[model samples]
Each structure stands twice: as C-alpha cells, then as structure tokens.
Target: MKNHSGHDMAGHNGHGGARPGGLSVSENGYTLEFDSTIFSAGAQTVTFRVTGPDGRPVTEYTPEHEKELHLIAVRRDTAGFQHVHPVMDEKGTWSTVVTLEPGDWRFFADIHPAGHDGTMTLGIDASVAGPYDPRPIPEATGIARIGEYTVALGGELLPGEASELTLTVSRNGRPVTDLQPYLGAYGHLVALRVGDLGYLHVHPEGAPGDGSTEPGPEVTFMAAAPSGGTYRFYLDFQHNDVVRTAEFTVRTTAVPRPDTAPGTAPGHTNHHHAHH
Candidate 1:
C-alpha cells in the first residue's frame, strides 16, 4: 500500500475540508486508486482499491444509506455517469471493475457511517490511459414541469471559483412559488461537470431571519465548479406532494484576476443576471 502525507490531503480546495464530519480521503487524497494504463476495446474491466482514513485499510466499516458505500463515477465532461457498489474484500480493500472509454474521469465514494445520518464525500481522479477525442457538450435540453420536479441541464465550469446561477420556474406561464420543503431542505441541486461529471452538491441559503418562510418563483444558488469544463445541472423542488425539476445549461468562465469580481462580467455585477 502507498502512503500519503498530511499536506497532500490538505491541498484540495474543491471541498472545504479533506475530512469533514469524520470523513477523510485516502493518503493519496483519493479514497480509491486505479490502474489507468490498461483498456479493452469493447467491454473492459478496470480494477480499483479503496483505502480508509487511517491510511491503512478500510475493512468491515459500517453501512449507511442502505449500502456500505455509494460510489459514483463520471467523466469530467458529463459524458458518463455510473452509480456502482464496490465489493469490500476481507483485507480492508474495496474493488470493482468498470468498462470505461478513454478519457479523464473522477470517482466519488459516498460513505454513510453506521447509525449516523451523515454521509462523507471521498474521491479521486483517474483516466483510461489512451487517446480519444472527448465528446462535445450536449445541447441544453429539457423542460421544467410542475409535477416532474427535476430539470435537464447544460453548462460549463471553472475550478476553484464560485459561480452564481439563477433558475426561474413557472407553471402554465405563471410564476410558481409556495414550494414546500423536501428532504429537510428547501431545494436539492446536483451539478456534474460535462466531461467527468464531477459532482457538486449545492444547497440554497434560506431566507434571512428566524422562523421565516419564503417560497419562490425564482431560486438562486451559488455553486463552485470542481474543474473547468461544461456541466449539467439538475434542480429539484417540491409543492403540494408533487416534485418538480428544472434543468439549465451553464459554462464556467476561466478564473478572473484578483481585482475582478468572481462571478461578474467585466465591470458588471452578477446580480444584473438574475432570472426573476
């Protein structure tokens, strides 16, 4: 087993902490390691191993979310999305074989602790060692309907920076607010970078002041892309026992200079871009 230094784990600016809420990445800053040099023409098998926070082995850990671990792998550009369950071997190693195309990618291990409601996000980056033209970002398509509660998405992203996104939702041409709460939060937003589908879980900032409730015909969120690329977004909202999803396309601009506003166009406040 390879050992990783403490500083290596601290270097990730993607998430606020390497180990938030007792969840830590493996020594190499990734929960899993893969042999990227090999690939098969059609259906190929790629093997990977999972490591624990102790930098040793992760054997017999507790299960959460109805599974020991929920693993999601996606190409950085949203080309592929896979939800997989890895087999935990007795030696504290979790292994899985996935057939992948030649491209750069990322993997996320969503681990839930036993008897705890919290889930840890552990991840790593890897690629199929070969050369292939990446697929272009698919056109932004999908309609946000009242009952569906989910949207189709498209966009681009930049790493280490925050981007502001505004989503407007209406039913039959009328603004829809009074959205009820779902999953203990006002809304659930999921973002995936287009090529690798690097996942960004986002939450909306609630209304200011205590015990105040506000629904929306418009919802705004701040999201930081994990890397620079095209991305797809899915926003899920609920009302009257019905869920609705709104999808949008976004392309993250390159990081600006320190003097420039992060999410603004040259000399313009991003607030002007509001969707309401």
Candidate 2:
C-alpha cells in the first residue's frame, strides 16, 4: 500500500511523477500532517492526522492486509527500519511510539479510506534533534543473518511483472521447518528502493493455513519492481516463538535489447549483497 501514486508503476519505478510514499506530505487531497516533525531522540509517541480534500479529518478507512494503516519509519541511511501500526482516535489522529536516534527520518503512511476507491501512500519527513551521525548504505546482497538465523534469497526480479521470490531459512546451517505464522502468513516481505526508500508492493504467495503452504524452510513471495535499481528486501518470519527480520539487497535483471545478438549481455546487470 505504500507505493500508490499516478506515477507509481510497480514495474517502471524510475518514471517521473509524484514520488513514492514518504516523499510527499500531501497527495490527492489527502494530507499527512503531523503534530510535530521535530522530536527528541528517545522513546516517544508521535501523533499525526490525515486531512481529506475538504480539510477535515478522515475517520473511516478500509482495512488492508488486516490493518487499516501501515506506518514505516526509517532513517535516511537505512540504519533503522520499523514497520508499526498506529491506533487512531475519533479525531482521525493516529499515534504510535517509536525509538528515535539523531538523524533524518522518513515516514510512510499506507492507507485506504472506506469511501475511497483505492489505497494511497503518503510520505513525510521528520527531523530528530541530536548528534546526527549518518550511516553508510551497504552494497546489494541476497543473504542476511539475524542472530542465529540465516536467510538465502532465490529468484530474479523483472520490471512490470510479479516476480517469484523464494526465501529459505536456516539456523546454524540447519533448515527450519517449523516456522510460525507471522501476520497470517508464513512470512511478510517488504521492498524499498535504494535511493528514495520508495516502498514496493509485495505479496506472499499463499497463506499459512493453506493446505499447500509449508511452515518453514521455504517461503515464497510475489514482488513487482517499478524499475531496475538497487532494492532492499526484508523478510519477517517467526521461529521458536521469536520473530526476526532478514535483510537482503538485490538488483533487477536487465532486459536484452532487440539488436543485441544471442548470448550477448545487456547493459544492466544484477547484484546481490547479504547483510550480516
């Protein structure tokens, strides 16, 4: 839901248009207005409201993926990424607590109003006051290690289409077969473009309770990329009653030119980087 915009083409991400969610404060008559954009570095409750075209609070929203709204906050350097759901009051104010550090932050609100025809993802920036030490962005990788778990990614991403992606989970080099369900699925995958932190729509292939879906070792997802570029993927899965996320950075494959001879490589290439 974070990628909706007239300019948002899941397969053609680089086309010029309205930026992805978290890049604009207002879109399509809906505004993502926060009570304050400057906050102290610590645990704090951030409050924001959505105003409709009529300049009034929007109180009714249709739920997507079992949540009315998804809030994603990440540091500019991609050092900190947190996806949380906020509670809304009658006044259309949504509030949630998040730990902040010194630096710039990006906030993406993915929502769909009850009366609206489709979902809208709006973006805004918040400045955290403190010693702003920036973090460096790492190279793309297909593997990520969190604690004792290791996740290996397989499959290629093509623009303008739902690419099949398979994620395998292991612990201490042993395959995990009893993974618990997270958010009604065996796993949840989030894709964000490298430069702008543009959110991409990613859907899991099947549900946890489905007879054909397995609990662990292999979790499949269908992801669409708007353009060829560096993209970071986060997979959330639960094992041993603990939930953890695996991070991987990948580049989409390039299309072969019509004039290019057979077996000739295209101008674009794919790269994978694993985060430890």
Candidate 3:
C-alpha cells in the first residue's frame, strides 16, 4: 500500500508481529471517529464510524462472537466499565447509549471488516461534562459481587503466557446453573491494565450449545497480560433474561527480563490513574 508520497503504511510493516489493540484511535488503515467527545453526566447516545484503508466508512464487517462489533467504555479511573453492542446502518455509522459519570472515559471499538485481514480495536478519548473528581484505585481482589451474583475467580494471570481463568458465579449462596447465553456464549470477559486501560482480547474456552460446554456456575476464558501489572477484569453474564457485570481486580506475575531487574517499573503500574 502506498500514499501520494509512495511510502509504506507504518502499521503494515510486513513483519506480522502480534500486538495489542485499543490503545490508539487510529491504526493500520482503520480509525474510530465519534460524533462528539464531550458529554453531560447521565445517559447519552454515541455515534461513530469506522473508516478503513480507502478512507471511506466501513460498512462490511464479519460478525465475531455473534456481533459485528463490540464497544467497551470505562472511566479513566477504571470505573464504570461497560461492554455494549451497537447497531450499524447502511451508511456505516454505529450508535449506542452509555451512562457517564463525571470523569474522563475511553471508548474502544473492536471491529473486523468483511475483507480485512484481521480484527482491530481502535480507541478514542471522551470527556464527561462535569466536575472531574477521579476515583482512587482499589485494592486487588479475587471476589466480586454484582446485584445478586457473587463471582469467585480461580487460576493465575502471568505475563507473556496464556493463562486460564475460571470464574464461578453464584447467588444467595447457591451456585447458578442455568446461565443464559449472552453473545453466543455463557459470558464475555474483558481485561484491561489499570493505568493505560490497554485492552486485552480474551477468548472464552467454549461457546454456548457446544457439546462439552455447560451453561452455568462457571465460565472459563484465556487471557494474557501485556506486562506484569494491576489489571481490571469485567465479566458479563446473562441469567433470568437480565445481564449484569462483575468486576475483579488482579495483578500478574512479572516475566524475567535480561536488561531490567525483577522489580522494574517499565511493565508495571505505580497505582496512579494516569489520564490519557
């Protein structure tokens, strides 16, 4: 690919090295454009378009995990985590509604064009119109409760290697066994490192209706940290025709590096919520 200057695109260097997504608003040939970046506190609608290599709105997309795209939004302080699916029109514009608090927020658009080589996660910053008093980071925990559900996490999150995380859900001291299918699965999980909110794309172990997959009590997924740091995990599950999210805080064990010591800060968080 070449522009008027006949230079290769920076993101398509041909090396094919695997990298994380959702860190930038534009990458390779895809861009996440929003209608407005400023919003007042409360429920509001967000409209955006994804432009591909040709600089036109991307209208053709292959659905991944039962949807054309997934939008993940969160406040800078790791509060108000939301994963929503938006509907796209013939004009290639997508829209969704989100609840906003008084703080900075990041919106990640995870999409895969019909003819594109791979999926891309483009992110843009959004500001809420109000007094900005960011929340402080909380202590790491393995247990999280949302509504009437309590989820207990099992397994480790290590840097540089795929780790299996098993989350068991129960309500009122009784294990939930009849979880409804959400997005073609029993659950959907999103992991983001605390500071930068770098997105970690995770895959569930199995989908609903699979012969070996069960609907309830436990949902398994595979996730790897980009680096050793404190991270936030949000899991969405459906039951009784309602969906709720359970948030968990966990830290990964650092991977040894030759140049850096075991306790280096390069790939770790200082616990401060940095505004991007």
Comparing candidate 2 with candidate 3, which one achieves the higher lDDT? 3
For model 3, residues 138-170, the per-residue Cα lDDT tens digits are 777789988778999999875544456899999
**Which one wins by TM-score: 1 or 3?**
3
Q: RMSD to native for every prediction?
A: 9.2, 5.8, 8.2
Instruction: State which candidate has the highest lDDT.
Output: 3
Give the runs in model 3 whose Cα sits over 4 Å from its true position: 1-18, 256-276
Q: How does residue 239 of candidate 3 score in lDDT?
A: 91
lDDT of 2 by residue, 160-262 (tens): 4444689999999999999988767888777787888877645566677879998879997755565567777777788988879888878875464354456
What tens-digit string does per-residue lDDT give for candidate 1 at 1-276?
000111111113323112221123452333655545345434555555555455554555566423676566656665555556778767756666666777876677766433333445666776676676777666655444445333322222334434455565666566667776654455666666554344565555454223654576656555555444565766767777866555555665445535556554321234322311
Give Cα distance to truth, residue 261, candidate 3, Å.
17
By TM-score, the best candidate is 3
Off by over 4 Å in 1: 1-107, 111-119, 123-136, 140-159, 207-213, 255-258, 261-276
